[model samples]
Target: MPDAMKILLFLLTICLGSIIMQPSVAQTVVNKPSAATADTVTVRGRVTDAQTKQGLPGVTVLVKGTALGVSTDTNGFYKLVVPSIRAVLTFNSVGYATVERKLDAKATGARVVNVALHPDTKALQEVVVTGGSPSQALMGSVSGVQSQAAHDRKQKRGGVSVQIQGISSMPRAPWYGRSESYATIQENSFHTARKEPLSTFSIDVDAASYSNVRRFLNDGQRPPRDAVRIEEMINYFTYDYPQPAANEPFSVTTELATCPWNPKHQLLQVGLQGKKVETSNLPAANLVFLVDVSGSMSGPDRLPLVQSALRLLVKVLRPQDRVSLVVYAGAAGVVLEPTPGTRRADILDAIDRLQAGGSTAGGEGLRLAYSTARKYFNKEGNNRVILATDGDFNVGEQSDAAMERLITEERESGVFLTVLGVGEGNLQDKKMELLADKGNGNYAYLDNLDEARRVLVRQFGGTLFTIAKDVKLQLEFNPARVQQYRLIGYENRALADEDFNNDRKDAGELGAGHTVTALYEIVPVGAPPVVDPLKYQANPAVAPASATADVMTVKLRYKEPQGSTSRLLERALRGTATPIVQASENLRFAAAVAQFGMLLRQSDYRGSATFETTAKLAEGARGKDAEGYRAEFVRLVKTAEAARRPTEDPESYGVR
Candidate 1:
């Protein structure tokens, strides 16, 4: 087998045999025009979503009618250099409209451009409603509006609104196939950490949405296309972390391609293996299912999705794994107890008979799930309580603080928790996140069957496996040789300088074969920093280092899977960058995404970034977008900028 294919198989075996879910490496579409003859002019821009004010990942910046375009990297940044300074850049995406901006002749001296995209279509026709009223779409940002030309600033919702509407237990039998759309909505919100201050985002898909999409289409007008939530996508993949072996059972691959529709924005294709674990080798899992069968779950995406996803998981339990079911509505009750995993029929039978009703007694259900799990705890086996809900735990422990405390106590009992979120409208990601972080477990949203398979079946191990604990990173830059550096993303994941060595410090987890990449867009002493002039007085006493260094040293600290004490791993990034006379595909993709994000938030530090330059640079980086996702990214960039048109009147849109 080819080396890459062989590596893929090996990883797949590891995934199937072990337990732990891994993260995606993040890919990009390079728009680097051939250096040989193309009259390449670099473009730099920030790509961000207008609604959540978050960076738009894998956005494409393209020069219309040419293969000249690039895709954003994991950081939602990109840089492309095109063949001509006068080329027009386009932006497009799945649910967003198309946009474009032109690069004038004065390209070299051009600064960074920021692009913000508003949510375009929230097909009110579909039963699954995500975001806000169409009329409300244009009001996302006061800045975007005040900055926009009066004529163009008019939309119902200027910004995107993402939220969980509520739980619906109603049947969506006919439209089950389209459920992935709602699933993606949850994933998108979760992945973004739901930190964007969206003015109107809400997840309001009715349980009837599954069937309603087709019904809406039958009347001539098409229903709204469900936005696929990717957070759920990654969380769904089950990884087998730290399970050393000759091969892995599954592998995940991300590809950047041109979108089949839009020529500007790029398409990012994330795929995983399809396999099942044997009934044997599986641990004796004491699983207590905390299902929110409240009246709120009366929709197809809520109760039905939860029931269907659970049924899929039930089928995998072996005779050795013990199962229990706890349901919460007006009252919490144990529907099943200590059932054998091998008795799949019995477990699913119980699930099949469940019905949603009454108020959500979420706290009561938690107490019961814990009580049940502790009763069946195995010293040498897996023990966990999985909560399936839309996050409307209103009846009990409704506050985030209460949920945090409960999760903290649950972790002490040696019974981990995994949250399988369903539906959109009423999800409380903040509460679910707290539960997962404190409980030493994880959280996910089950948007559809594809997602269910990705999370429950394909990545069962990684999702359940614990390899290392308290993973933290401390980059010790040799200040003597360096000027200044910035750490991208991880705003919330950042660790205090002291947290690096503290073994007890809780931090992000990395699954086996999972890669956590952080970039330090640095400025050498000789080079200018992204930050403006020092805000404080200069340290005259502190002498600069005499010698110059090429790269920074990175130190990684992690604890053994079961051991609390910490361990250390170190690696140094070394390369002699010759002033970057010209940029590469990789460099531009990251830069573009960053710029796009900065633009969206009107970040103070988006130096040298502009939609025009970003477009040109992204145009330079379109490297092998076999699936066309990258090309689509460029289009997304254009569509976003055009929607809020930075070109019509740059000052009004605050392009500076």
Candidate 2:
């Protein structure tokens, strides 16, 4: 501005200019910090009920308008990281009104934001009482009504129990706006072995139906008839079956026992024990967690539970493995790139940052997840996409048929899919099941944290690593020894007899260390036939092999995870049948489960099967009870019995 010699006045002007310019530079620094220089603020707080002041677990705390969030722990404690102290946070939980808070802009370091949410009256009002005949209450509604009445009586009597009668016919109305969907399940009928000697179906390793049914029972509601898949129920529990010998992927065991339901018939238990693979020896994994953070998943049981379940899997991740997270809600995007499992904290941080609120673009999410998995495709390793959602796809490619096609096409790339279904009321069980089936994967329903542990931790190998795919089972009953037979379940898994040998056909995936079981009820030659003899044609002469003591032949087809051609396994079951009381624990436990399923389904063929008998059988057969799962099954049977209508005849409930 001036030559120093020119004037002191020139120097004064330069000094003023320097002061103004220096302040402007300082303001710029304060307003916008460089990306690398910016600091993340840590936020900690608790979420509690407004009225009760009790801590609320699974409350979703989020940085408003962003995907970053965290769910409160069991004691309602939560800690989150935000870009700045000025960030706005939102807290959401089921049955509670959403709450929002803005942080102090002038604050520094970590911040604290406690929230107390009030009950949402509108949500509570969704379930209202209405008058209807008990018969019109559907499978599970009567029990709910009776429970409510009993509660009212207890309250009136000052906690002193009093028998409430004449209220058996009362029915509670269903909650409004539920959209859960299940494919119809028609019970299998007896097939005259003389006419149809073969039974064919895809082996279903999925136990989603069993847990889903248990959810209903625990809620004091009878599961929907179509929701009870007997095969899934029987296979959910582990059996003491021998492991496969060398060069085999699984071992097949067969047991024949007097049918607990119909003593006149026999129960044949077919168990497949997949060869166990130690976790340390498993191939490196390339996994893409396709998480749904849609509006529907905002519920505590949905996204929150998903986070907890996935965390369990993460804990077992090895350094050689890699994980990527892709989330979808109105759109699809990858929150984390392919990160090595060694970066456990980074992966977990990414998971904790997830928040739910938007429409579901499930199809788009699948596309992105597969693309991610393929980009980091690990040859000679496990490549898979783990999808956790409520199966509610409302925004894009929403139909079950559309999802099935998309998953089917994506699976051809050798990236398997594992659908972890959570939440209820709007759970699209049919869609999830179809996706898993078509995607050459398995599905499990996480009803509680215990189930999450069982699926992701206790049975880690069986949950994530696939040893065999396209597994199908076919049984040829010896018409000479068996007059008629019916498969206990696998209604939807039925396959054309020819499909067993069709290498190109898709079937179920068998995970490492997984156990699959199937039950068959057989009417021996001397038993009364379920149907009159065919008048048009006489039965063909029994072959020499059929005349032997062999009751049936079991044939199984399977393909290696990476193989195109299938391998075969076969075994013949002898006709000797042991009394039900003397059956092995595996046989008796499995029979008990099948009997309970029949009773629940009210199957026409459930001869002499009673809840009391089911309980007794399960109680006696709960050997080794290492995990207490068998004992839990017995408890569930008792629960179902207690919930049954008082006036409903035991015979109608599967008792002879």
Per-model C-alpha lDDT, please?
A: 0.50, 0.78
> Against the true structure, whose TM-score is highest?
2
Candidate 1 ranges with C-alpha deviation above 4 Å: 1-284, 318-320, 530-550, 577-656
Per-residue CA lDDT of candidate 1, range 197-247, in tens?
111111110112222222222221222323222122122222222222334
Model 2, 328-412: lDDT tens digits are 9999999999999889878866775677888999999999999999999988999999999998888778877788788889999
Candidate closest to the true structure, highest lDDT: 2
Please give the range of 10 consecutive residues that has the lowest summed lDDT in model 1: 197-206
Q: Estimate each model's TM-score.
A: 0.53, 0.73
Error of 1 at 405 (Å): 1.6
